[model samples]
Target: MQQIILQPQTPDELRLVKQFAKVMKIKATTIKETPKARKKREILDGIERGLAEIKLHQEGKITLKTAQQVLDEL
Candidate 1:
């Protein structure tokens, strides 16, 4: 079975979608994440990864690019 994800812009639209899903015998699950919440999640994830990389670099397990290298790449 194929699954679909919907982002309803309004509460009424969300209700309508859920109702349609119910009438179609489809399972409707609500997963809430506002734009701000998603952005915060992404930032936290990036910070976690950066910390992990720093730990690895300190342990001599990985080499990170220098500022010049990063700038050159950009």
Candidate 2:
């Protein structure tokens, strides 16, 4: 058996495609995480890294100022 992937342009098309799949016995695994989801993951990763830096700052391993101070230095 072969597999086919689809990217429907509209909500109506998505609904229709899912209905067609149901009638055709084609098992569908709707992905909860898509390209947008990948982008979200990237954002969360950056947040985690920033939090790690903040933790270091809290331990006095690095000394950083507020946003306004950084901006003033620029």
Candidate 3:
């Protein structure tokens, strides 16, 4: 693995790097590999699709009455 060195001249820079390292480590530990990441991506894609549908409805590509009816059904 490659190594990184943080040469912080100021106390604030040192503190910032420490906090950044902590968060980076936490994220590295929690990272999921391909299959799990794909599942997460699918879920996010569904959410984006839903948002796009709502936007289209608002923009008049889809009727407001139909949108309201769908929202009511939900």
| Whole-model lDDT values for every prediction | 0.95, 0.89, 0.72
Could you tell me the lDDT of residue 20 within candidate 1?
99
Clashes of each: 0, 0, 0
RMSD, each candidate, Å?
8.4, 10.4, 13.3
Q: Give the clash total for candidate 3.
A: 0
4-72 per-residue lDDT for model 1 (tens digits)? 989888999999999999999998899989999999979999999999999999999999999999999
**Estimated TM-score for each candidate:** 0.58, 0.46, 0.40
Best by lDDT: 1
**Per-residue CA lDDT of candidate 3, range 18-71, in tens?**
788797783322232489877997899999998998899888897555667889
Poorest lDDT segment (10 consecutive residues) of candidate 1: 1-10
Ranking by TM-score: 1, 2, 3
TM-score of candidate 2 to 2 decimals: 0.46
Q: Candidate 3 — which residues are off by over 4 angstroms?
A: 1-33, 64-74
Model 2 regions more than 4 Å off: 1-33
Which pairs clash in the backbone of model 1? none
